[model samples]
Target: MKAMSKWNKSVALLTALILVLGVFAAGCGGNEESDAIKIGVNYELSGNVATYGTSCKNGIMLAFEEINKNDGVLGKQIEGVVQDNKSQNREARNVAEKLVSEGVVAVIGPATTGNVQAEEPVLTKAKIPLLATAATAPEVTYDEKTKKVRDYVFRVCIIDPDQSQVMANYIFDELKLKTGSILVDKGNDYSVGLGKTFKEYFTAKGGKIVAEEGFVDTDTAFKPQLTSISSKKPDFIYIPAYYNQVGLIIKQARELGVNLPIMGADGWDSPKLVDLATADSLNKCYFTNHYSVEDPAERIQNFVKAYQEKYDSTPDAFAALGYDAGYLMAEAIKQAGSPDPEKIQQAIADIKGFEGVTGKLSYDEKHNPIKEVSIIEMANGKQKLIKKMLPEH
Candidate 1:
C-alpha cells in the first residue's frame, strides 16, 4: 500500500470532522428528547387587562406545580416558558415568535381574542399549537379569511356566540324580557363579536333590540348612552366590554336611574368590578362566565378550595380557563406519546369530552370549547351563580 497524499489526508480529516459533528448533533437531540417538555405561556401580565392575565397565570402555575409534583406527563417534567405581552397586539405577536424560536411545542395564549389572533399567525407558521385561555371570539379558532379552522389555535373558553346566546335566551325566554339595549366597545373585537351574536340570536327569537350604542374603550362616561337606552325603556341592557369599563358603565347607568337588568359576557368577572361599580350598583347585573365558585360539582368545589388556599382569593373564570388549558395540554401530550407539535395538535383535536373545573370540555369543529355558560349575578359585592345554560349544539 502506498502512503496517501496531503490532499487525501486533508479530505479524510474533513470527513472525520463531519462524522464527529453528526454524532454530537445526534447526541444533543437524544438528550433533549429525554429532558423537560417546553410549554410557552404568553400572557398580559401588565396592561389594561392585567387582572385577567394575572389570574390565568396563577392558575397555569398551580396546574404545573401539581403536575410536576406528580412527576409530570410522559415521565418528563413540564418546563413552562412564561412571558408577559403587556396586553398589546404587537407584543403578543412578538412573544409568540420568541416562544417559537425557543422551540416550544405549544403555547398558552393571551386571555383576550385580539391578542390571541395576533399570535396565531406566528404559531401557525412555526407549526406550534396554541391553547388560548379565554379568547372566545369565533374567529380565534376559525379564520374568517381562510374560511377554515385555524389548525394551530384552540381556546378553552366558551365562544362569544355561545355565551351571548345564553345571556340572550336567559333574558328573553327565562327572564321574560322582550326588549333590551346593547353597549359595546367598538374597537374591541371581543365586545363587537358578543354584541353582534347577542343581537342576532335575540332578534331571531322574536325579541327586540330597543337601542344600541358603540363606545371607544378609553371613554369614561356611559351616561349619555345609558340615558338614550333608558329612554327606550328596554327591559335589559347588554354591555360587552372589559371589567373596568363595564364596571364604570354599570355604576353610571345605575346612577342615571337606568334600572334595567344589565348583562354582559365573561368580561365582567373581575373582583375589581364590585369596587368599580359599587355593590349597590351591581344589583340585577348579570354576566355569562366560564365557571362560578358557587357551583356544586365536586371538581369545581375542589378547585375553588385549592385555589383559595393557594392564592388567598377565589379563582375567577379566567383562572379556571387557564387551569383547564394547562391540564388539557398535558393530556394532549400524554395522548400524543411525543412532544411533537403536530402530534399534540392531533391529540387535542381528538379530545371528545374532558372534565375540568369549568365543565365538560369538548371541542367544536372550530376548536372552540364546548362548555356550559354560567350566568353569574353580581349582588352585594359578591357573585352568585344564577343558572348554567348548556349550548344548543
Candidate 2:
C-alpha cells in the first residue's frame, strides 16, 4: 500500500510540472503577438491648421483599422502613435523627433507645407520614411537643377507647380479673366509656393497681375489690402492660401466693393469657406482640388458612404488624400514583403498606376504623384463641381 501511494504522488508532481511549463510558453507567445509593428502619425491637431490635420488623421486611422481587421501587415498587428504639432514650427520639429524615438518604421504627415518643411530634415537624419499627405510646395522634394528629393523626404500629393498651371489654365482659358490682383498668405509655405507659380504662369498666359499684396495667416482684417486691390480695378483676385484667411479676405473684399471672380488652390476645400462668405460673395469664387465628391468612381462612392456613415458629414480633399496615403504605404509594404525602410522606400518609388479613391496615382521621380485635379466653385453656400482635368504630361 505504501509503494502504490508513493507512485501516485510522483505522477501528480510530474503533471503539475508539465502544466507550469505549458503556461510559461503560452504567456511568452501571447506577448510576442501583442507587440506588433508600429507606425507614427504627426499632424497639427491644436492650431490654425487643426481642421485639416484632424481630418487627415481620421482618414489614416480609418484605413489602418480596416487593414488590421483583415489580419494585418506581415502577419503581425499594426499600431500607430499620433502626435500633435499645434501648427507651430518648433512643435512640428519636436513631434517628428518624438515619432522617431518611438521606433516607428514610417511616419506620415505634418500635413501643411510649413510643418513638413520644419520636420523633414529631422526625419531624414533618423533614416525613417516620411510621407507628407498634403504638403504641395515645390521645394518640399527638390532643388533647382536636379529636382531630386532629400534621402528621407517624400510627398503623396501633387506639387504646387502642377496645381498652379492647372489653375492658370482654368482661369485664363475657361473663366477668361485677363487681369487680376494677387493676395497671398505670407506665413505659409503652401501659399508662397502657389502664389509664385500662379504669378509666373498667369503672366505667361497674357493675364496681367495689376496689384500684389500679402497678409499673415493670423490676420483677420484684409480691409487695408482689399482697399488697395480694389482700387486697381482688376477683373479677379487670386488668393493662394487656406480657406480661413480666404473667407475673411472675401468677406472683406466684398464689403469694400471689390467683387470680382476669386480663385485659389486646393487649400480652399473646406466648409468654412461657405460659412464665412455670403451667397452673393461666393458665387464667382473657384479653387482647384484633388478629387471631387461628385465623381462617379465606384471606389470614391464607397469611400464617401463609409465616411458619411462614420463622420456624419461629407469628406473633404484632406481626408481623401490621407486615405490614399495610407493605402499607398500599405501597398508598398505588401509589395516589399517586409518593413525594411530601404526596401519600402524603393518600392514606393517604383509604384505606378495605383488606383485610389482620389484618382489614378503614379509617382514621379521626385516622389510626387501624377494625378488629375478638380476645379470647384461655390454656389448657394455649397460646393459645385465645375470641371476635371487630366494632367497633360
Candidate 3:
C-alpha cells in the first residue's frame, strides 16, 4: 500500500511539472509574436492629393524593405499599418486615433499641412511622435502664441517660411525680378502661409508686391484674378498653391497673354502638373523643391538608381522626403534601443548630421530639419536643377 501511494504522489508531481513547462513555452511564443514592432502611416491615399500620398507611401515601403533586409531596428521586424485619410481633416484625425488605438509606436505622415494640423491635437494628447513627410507650415512645429516648439511634432521637409524665402531671394537676387504679383489659395494653410512669408521677405528685400489676389480651392475661374494681376505688369506671378490649381492658373494665365515667368513653392513638384498644363505653358517656370535627381552626388545617384529599379519610375521630392522621414524614424528607434515613444522622440531630437537622400539633416530646437532647398525649373517638360539654396543662420 505504501509503494502504491508513493507512486501516485510521483505521478501527480510529474503532471504538475509538465503543466508548468507548457505554460512557460506558451509565454515564450507570445513574446516572440509581440516582437513585431508596428509603425503607422496615415496619408491621402485616395483623394485630391493621391499622387503625393502614393509617392510617399512607395518611398516609405522601400525604406522599410531595406531595413528589414538588414535585420530591422532593435532586432525586431517593422510592420507598417497604413490608413488612407482621403485628404479630409476629420478623416485624418480619425485615422490618427485608429493608429494609436492599434498600438503603433510612431506615426509617419499625412503629407499636407492641413491634415497634419488636423491630426496634431490627437497625437499631442496621446504623446505619440508625428514625423511629417511633407507638411511644411511654420506653425506645425512652432506655436507663436506659446513661443515654444510642440514637443511631439516634427517634420522632414523645410518649413514654408524657409522655402518661400528661398524662392523670394532667388527671384529678387538671382533672377533680378523687382516686382511680383501673388495668387494665393485662401482655403489652404500651405498656400496662405507660403504667400505671407514670401511677401514679407520679398518686400523686405526691396522687391515690390504690385498686386495680390486670392482664390478658393474650388474656384475654377482664375481668369478674373489673372486679368487684374496682368494689368499690374509685374515681372513674375507668384502662385503659392498646389499643382492642381496652379496648373489651371498657369494655363489660363497663358491664354490671357500673361507671359511673365511664374514661380511657386514645393507644391508644384508633380507629373500631373505637366498633364494639366501644356509643356509650353510651363516654360520658364520654377519652384523650390527638396531633391533633384539631376544631382551628381553619389548618395543621390544611388537612391535614384535603386528607386528607378524598384518602382520603374524616378522619385520626386515627395518620395525623397518620405524616404528621409522613414530612415530617420528607424535611426531614432535604433538609437533608443526600445519601442518607447518618449525615448524615440528624444532620440530623434538628438540626431545630427544624419546623411539623407535629400541632404544632411539635423533637428533644430523646433524639431525642423536643417537642410538645403533645391530650386528646380521646368525645362522642356523635365525638371532641371537650377541652384541649391543653403539656409541662412
Ranking by TM-score: 1, 3, 2
| CA lDDT scores, all candidates in order | 0.88, 0.83, 0.89
Clashes of each: 0, 0, 0
lDDT of 3 at 330: 95
TM-score per candidate, in order?
0.85, 0.81, 0.84
lDDT of 1 by residue, 1-393 (tens): 235587788899999999999779756864775488989999999999898899899899888888989999999999787899999999999999988987889999799888998999999999999999887777888878989999989988887799888998899888999988899999988889889999999999999998999999889987888888888888999987989899899889888877878899877877789999999999998999889988888888888888899999988888888899899999999999999999999999998789888888888788888788899998788999998888776
lDDT of 1 at 346: 97
lDDT of 2 by residue, 48-103 (tens): 88988988888787778778898877886767667899988899999889778757
Give model 2's TM-score versus the native structure.
0.81
Candidate 3 residues 87-108, lDDT tens each? 9999999999988987888999
Q: Looking at candidate 2, what is the lDDT of residue 36? A: 70
Query: What global local distance difference test value does model 1 have?
Result: 0.88
Best by TM-score: 1
After superposition, the stretches of candidate 3 with alpha carbons farther than 4 Å from their true spots are: 1-33, 218-224
